[model samples]
Target: MISAKLLRVLAPKIARRYSSECAKDGFTVTVIGAAGGVGQPLSLLLKLNPAISELRLHDLVDVPGVTADLSHVETSCKMVFFTGTDHSEAICGADVVVVPAGVPRKPGMSRSDLFTTNAQVVYDFAVVMAKTNPGAIAIIITNPVNSVVPVVCEVLQKAGKLDPRKILGCSTLDSVRANVFLGEATNTDPKNAYVPVVGGHSGPTIIPLWSRSNPKLCLTNKKLASLTKRVQEAGTQVVKAKEGKGSATLSTAYAASRLTYCVLRAMKGETNIVESCYVASDIYPGLKYLATPLLLGKNGVEKNLGLGTINDEEKKLFCGAVEELQKDIKTGEEFVKSKNVK
Candidate 1:
């Protein structure tokens, strides 16, 4: 017996109430290397994220202490810890699983050098996720992401749980670094500088598209090359600066959290959330996986959003990146094949 005018007003209110309830439905995030330098800070960031209703910390050692320390935070998010064989418990029912569990990169070492050990670590985690939380969006922060991402993908495929959109290699760090470095050179705030970095996660495979940078920067070819090189070697620079004690943990955590937030927002049905991630794609011929900007959504990456406009120099760099990136990807595929991880 409601009037038409009353029904119109009530309908909008009901819709708003439903939206709020959906937003509060509780998101669970699991961190695989929760005791390491990257994991500790990454957990802190996840703890502070309002979208995450539960945070699961997993590691081989010292996870209990890390969990206890984070429990002191005033956030409403509940914290849990799992160690050793119980890592599977931490992963089950997770909405997002982040893998930063591996050996830290030392000075003078490329991400590829950490391959053999990290590949196995990432592989084991992928196996667990495929079995326990196959639908979860995986954000892999392990080194040699170009390869490790492929490793995870192949494992998931074997389990018949592969969703290309749900598995992502967190190459947002490269984009974050590009923004900061370009900000320094251009005297603009890094927050305002949007640089789309596409390619793989290491060395020449990291392609920073200066031509597509927001506010449109015009630099000489020499200057452009220098900035791109800096973005590519930025991790090495950080490793050396730390005197081989650590790699880029702080910045990496920030970037990973940024990407995680994007995923969470997308899960809440927020639209147009775009970020760079290394993911499986047929965008470029031959290479099965590469980093590019993706439009995130409720199910993870909704659109591939292939590389935007690039000039001659950038195109040449991209061609070279694809060649080297393919080799790294093959290495990962072969590693999984060797394990016979079905």
Candidate 2:
């Protein structure tokens, strides 16, 4: 029985009230493999997230100190530690689960080389997540992501809990590298450049579509090819630079954090949140899944925005990527099947 003029005045205030109330309900995020290079920094970054109410760190070892270290950070989010088999507690009721567990990639070792070991690790986490928190959005950061993501999907599907939209492979590192390198090339801020990196995560499969870069650049064919190659081999460059000490960790944590924030923002009902991630998609034929630009929303990937326009060079790269990616994906699916994981 409110008057029309009064209703309009109160509507904005009511909406603001609900938003503020929702903010209090914050999210709980769990990090599996929370002690490693990427996990430690990633956990610290998540600690800074205002919308996160709880940050759970789980690792086979070293979690107690890692949790204690992160607890000192001034943040509203409550920190929880889970070690050994008790890591199950971390997954319980988690809103988002990030898996970065597995052995670090040694120099001369490719993501695929880590696959045999990482697949089992990723599978174990997936099984627990599917059973306990099937509703949680899973971000798989374990390498050989092109394969690990599929393995996770298959596990969830077998458990009758598969929600493709809720599963994402963290390929944001590739996108981050592309943005930084391209920004450097153009004298633009990396934050301002939007480069859509599609295909897969490993060498030869990682395709950066310069034709679709926002704040686009004009470059010769030679320069474009060089930049694209740099994006694809950036990981290897880091591995070599580390003198076999470590792979890319700091930059990776930053990229993973960026992706996590994108997902969190979308969960908050933000509109038009687009990120490039490796997920199950129908964007290309023959390939069951690939990394493409996705418009994220409350339930996860709201829509799959396929590769826009690729130049001749990109098209050629895409063709080669499809061939290699298909094999990599098959390797993952086969790994799960071989384990009698149906």
Candidate 3:
């Protein structure tokens, strides 16, 4: 973690790159993989958010049915559907574009295992996001986010529409898990629990800082370590329990919706709206991105609240996660380079 003095000096400087755009009313939101497991449930939750005025759903085959189903809900959110690969209409002018467009994991499959196919799927959706609404907040919920987020950044940068401030990889799930696990371990209410998860989104790369937990936890070292490991391995545990049927769709939808609401609420002028997200950052050396808590605002990231003070064990975990994330980010940048770096 960086010093508070240094963070105070640098946060706003990094934040200045984003637009100061604000919204007086509700905003238009688009879901690129609206028919998928995570997308369907996420769309339902977003439809219920009072901040969204329009919800655009797009997919290859089943989006119409999904959108039609969501439209029946008693909400003022206007619904639209776009079938197939042509996402120009659905994505255009959206206030926020969320891409959960990728295949999910099965039993015994690591997140990295889905990188081959999901990377390309996320890449395609990102292209449309860059082209149609470069200024909109782009939230990525695809698997292998440690890599695919860099892929999206690369694609948008190539298109001359890169805005590091607004492009976020929704790492909120790790934080959500951290909160729940911490709460459960401490025998406190989960809703009152809050933990800041740093590093990347998968495996050993997920670092949950117990020092920052709200309601203050006082667990033994053994218990703390076990809880941290549980948060990192939670996705795998879920996949195994599902017996090859699906991944963490329901929980992921809930997590992604939390992130989406943060962005929407920020855009609508909510102050001090902070969330942990994987976005372009200089919080840690040698890695272009890390999941750090950020102060959200009208435009996007108003300030990066760098990882606060962590314990010896937390630092050790963070170091290892950083090393792994460096490779993960390279995997993403390399993919983009191979495809479009002319």
Using lDDT as the measure, the top candidate is 1
Each prediction's Cα RMSD?
A: 8.5, 8.4, 9.1
Per-structure clash totals for the candidates = 0, 0, 0
- In the range 169-262, model 2's lDDT, one tens digit per residue, is 9999999999988799889998788799999998888898888887787999899989988998898889899999999998888788778887
Candidate 1 vs candidate 3: the TM-score winner is 1
Runs off by more than 4 Å, candidate 2 = 1-22
lDDT of each: 0.87, 0.86, 0.85
| Model 1 CA deviation exceeding 4 Å by range | 1-22, 110-112
Runs in model 3 deviating more than 4 A are 1-24
TM-score for each model: 0.92, 0.92, 0.91
Give lDDT: candidate 1, residue 13. 52
**Residue-wise C-alpha lDDT for candidate 1, range 65-131, written one tens digit per residue:** 9999888766678999899955688989999999899998997665567997899899999898888
CA error at residue 129 for candidate 1, angstroms: 1.0
> What tens-digit string does per-residue lDDT give for candidate 3 at 258-301?
88887876787768788999999998889898899999987889
TM-score of 2: 0.92
